[model samples]
Target: MNTDPKVLIVTSAFGDGHMKVAEAIENSFRRRGISRITTLDLFAVVHPALNELSRRFYLNNTGYTQEFYGLLYTMTSKMRPEQFMGRLIHSMGKRKVQRIINEIQPDIIIHTFPYLAAAELASTTGSRMPLFTVMTDYVVHGRWLHPQTTKYFIASEDMKTTLMSAGVAEEKLVVSGIPIREAFEQTQDREALLRKHGLSGDRQYLLLAAGAYGVLSDISSLIKRVLLQSSFDVIVLCGNNHKLRAATGELFQENPRVHILGYTEEMQELMCIASCLLTKAGGITLTEAMAQALPVIVYRPLPGQEAGNAEWLSGQHLIEIARNEEQLVEQLQRLEHTAYRDEREQHMKVFSRKSASDAIVTEALEAIKLRQPSVPAAKSMLVEGQAKTIHGYY
Candidate 1:
């Protein structure tokens, strides 16, 4: 009698943030004793070739054709609810997604990606299973809203207002602060982490993470400039970009202050040991850096979501933006001041909420209980009201 609530976490691989959020939620479920869990990438399952091609195209475009990509993002962001793209995506993915739902019969389906699959799942008849969406970005886009989303776990109360203004009911939105892996929330002894990684703990560390795809621009130039300063050591995470690793290794081989690492599972440990993080403004990385309470220096954020994230974080004073090599050097130098570092750290403490995963898991469990047939009719009525209210928006 395996009676633990079944959960299906539907995510997409278009970006690493969605997958990371999925992993975080999955980890939270396991911690809460939910054994029956399934994680799936809708595109990978429904349209494998398109998934691969689109993912490749996205990576390449974000790395190179950023202007065109931003244009596309802006156009799509303004799409109306009746737009054809949503319907087209729903049609393409619905059958496969519905089949998965039929097989698993999960108590709930959690979506960490954009809401196309959720729109498909919602369109299915007799689809009583609750669907919850976790918005990885600080800003909300039109694509993230759907009538079928029973709840939205967004990054902040301001986002909740954004959704509500767009017609989402107050009860259906939770300000969860972007769920991140539990490992990030754990305290790491800075000295132990540095010793284990064979780095000097006495010196301040500037952690340069270019994301898992090595999407940042002019990383070598940034590294070269940072190395000229004797106040801090530079640690660069090149992720899975072999070309980048090779190029950087050759460039910095003689420099003892520089360390280049490939894709690593030790991000939490690394973030913990670093005095500050210098990276592009991917939502998950921003949240992760904030979780570690490490001051951030954002450099060359990509055109769309990354730019939005940078704007929000910088506005909050949780991060400093460096638009060029000169600005990057200046921001790095600014980190050396005790007042500046402490001020940013305090901002991080106020802005970052590490309990998002746990909070989401708890709310989901409650939603499941309310949806149970044994629950009171009044609770069911409330859910129905929410669904109807959301439908009115569409």
Candidate 2:
């Protein structure tokens, strides 16, 4: 008999943060010798067509329609979990999710997306499978709260306080930072990594990433300003955005100092090599950068979650924000100063939780052990209960 716990990680690809968090958790479980693991994309599994369309719509809106996206975010930001919009969003995927639960019969279900699957699983009669939700952002949204959630692995203490103020049980919240891959926690030899990537160890490197979608507007202008104003070599990661890659290649073809890459798996190494990072404020990316102790410069984050993340990190003095070309250039110059860089690194060391993924896995395993019944005993109880029911009926 296999005693290994079966874990079902439900995530959605609305943005890369959700999938990244799921991957981190999966990797943590694998490292801990938990073999029976399955990962499901909730939207893709429940409603394929809707998932694709909604994903496209989200990217388009976040990339091009800033005002409209901000409007939608503002309109729903303060809604209660039981509100009409929340219920409607959750109900859309509930039936399909329940079907998945019935088929998998997992020991525990972990969610990285804000979906209604938790509520459905909780409402299932006689179901005791632990349901855990990992909030990828620093702020808590109403959509992420469900009374039925067995536990919440949140990003920070302030987030926990917010959830508590909104009536979440104290025991249900755990400040595990954000679940990032274990690689981020390991000490990276900067010189070795630079050599491995065929990059110059002598040159001061600046990394600019626009999330995984390359959605930041006027990236070309930003790159140009950085190159013209700073002495550092610029490395732009155009993740899965071929158009952005092609455009950047054409624009910086003559500049040997500018390196443009597309969809790299060496983000950790690149971040380690960077003197500073100028990127949008995606939660996972920020966490990864923080892990490396790299000074961060955030520019023109999108209106909702990105804005909130930027605000929180800046408030903590862990990052610098540049809203325009001049401020960006100035921030880059500031990063060149040894004292400023050291200050930011010290702040990051204080802010970052290096063992977040491991901590989350430990908590999850303990929670599962407390809730799980011995299989043989569970089967015997079921048989005895059925027999008594039949006898009573006769």
Candidate 3:
């Protein structure tokens, strides 16, 4: 491995989960003494206006008409880069990627989000670099698949199997788990974290993870329902959504059991103290919660990739999925049983043992050591005095 490595982590703002995964991978690379890391939002860089419009459309479509989003997901599940929509999307950022490759000359390019267009720089244009794609969700959406991808860092064996079934070479896939923040790697003290958060062990905590957008629907009603079910306290994480936080705070301020908070960096601490989690099925949060052995309950997951993530994990008994308040509460009630909680915890711990970020870094670097001018990106960027390639994706 080079003493000083340049890494470009291409991510999107489609959801904060993808960006969070990129951050985690960046942190991991930094730990390896590799600096010169740049995290990019490729679409916004290529065409800011269109990116914003599409972003708004995504938010509106997913937040309101989720059934349509699911239908789209199903329709595009088998799309190839040569197909109409896929070709259009995959063609967006080639020039920007080539310019970026010439400018930064990164050693390796990792995609925490799925943007297949990056591969066109090398795959179609005869450039070369190591382009690794990391799937942040449980679903293997066709958007992420491409023949040019050097490696596929997937979430589970299930995804590897799916990709294999799709004719992807088995050797090209790595079940290294999803990359999480460096914070999850440290030893978190339960008692100390409890004191720091003004929480207690006496009361079981129900964590409502609204993620970065505060996307939890009818969250107040859900909180009220959970309160009615038990004496357990509630902690709401309204990420970046100040209005939702303020409204939730105003509504629940008088209730001693309910604590509504905006974005706080003490997420690991909160998850440490939490007895159960009620949230959407975004892969990054689910991976973080599972890594802490926290029982995850997906409540009315938005109908596309979220539904896919919830279904697969739930089927394996690793997590519970609820379509309504009643089922969500029922899942929480079941967690109250010591035996049931322990069983779920056991399933979660099995997954927690895999050090995803570290494994990814080690394997990527080892590949570099083994094959000097690895992949397309390395072809332009330098490796041992030769020009290197750029793993160009955003």
TM-scores for every candidate against the unseen true structure:
0.89, 0.90, 0.89
Please write out the lDDT profile of model 2 over residues 1-394, one tens digit for every residue. 2357888787876764777788888888888899887777766766779889878866773445776776787788777757788777777867556666665557788888887565755665546767888989887778887777888998899998999999999999999899888788889899898888788877888898843434345787777788899888998888777788887788888998999888787888888999998877778889989999999988877787888899999999999888888999998898888898999999998889977777877878887876644222111111122111000000
Supply the TM-score for candidate 1.
0.89
> How much is 8 displaced in model 2, in angstroms?
0.7
Q: What is the TM-score (0 to 1) of candidate 2?
A: 0.90
lDDT by candidate, in order shown:
0.77, 0.78, 0.77
lDDT of each residue in 150-173, candidate 1, tens digit only: 889999888888889888899899
Model 3, position 137, has a per-residue lDDT of: 89
Error of 2 at 386 (Å): 37
Clashing pairs in 2: none
Error of 1 at 337 (Å): 0.4
- Model 2 misplaced stretches (Cα beyond 4 Å): 61-64, 124-126, 210-217, 372-394
lDDT of 3 at 325: 81
Instruction: Report the C-alpha lDDT of model 3 over 1-394, residue by residue, as the tens digit.
Output: 5777777888887763787777777777888888788787766676679988867766763455677777888999998876788778788867766766667667778887677667866777654567889898888999998888889998888888899999899999998888887676566889988888888778899988754323445778888899998666899888677778888888889998998887677788888899998877888888888988899998877777988999999988899988888897888888888899999999988866356878888777765553334334423322231122122111
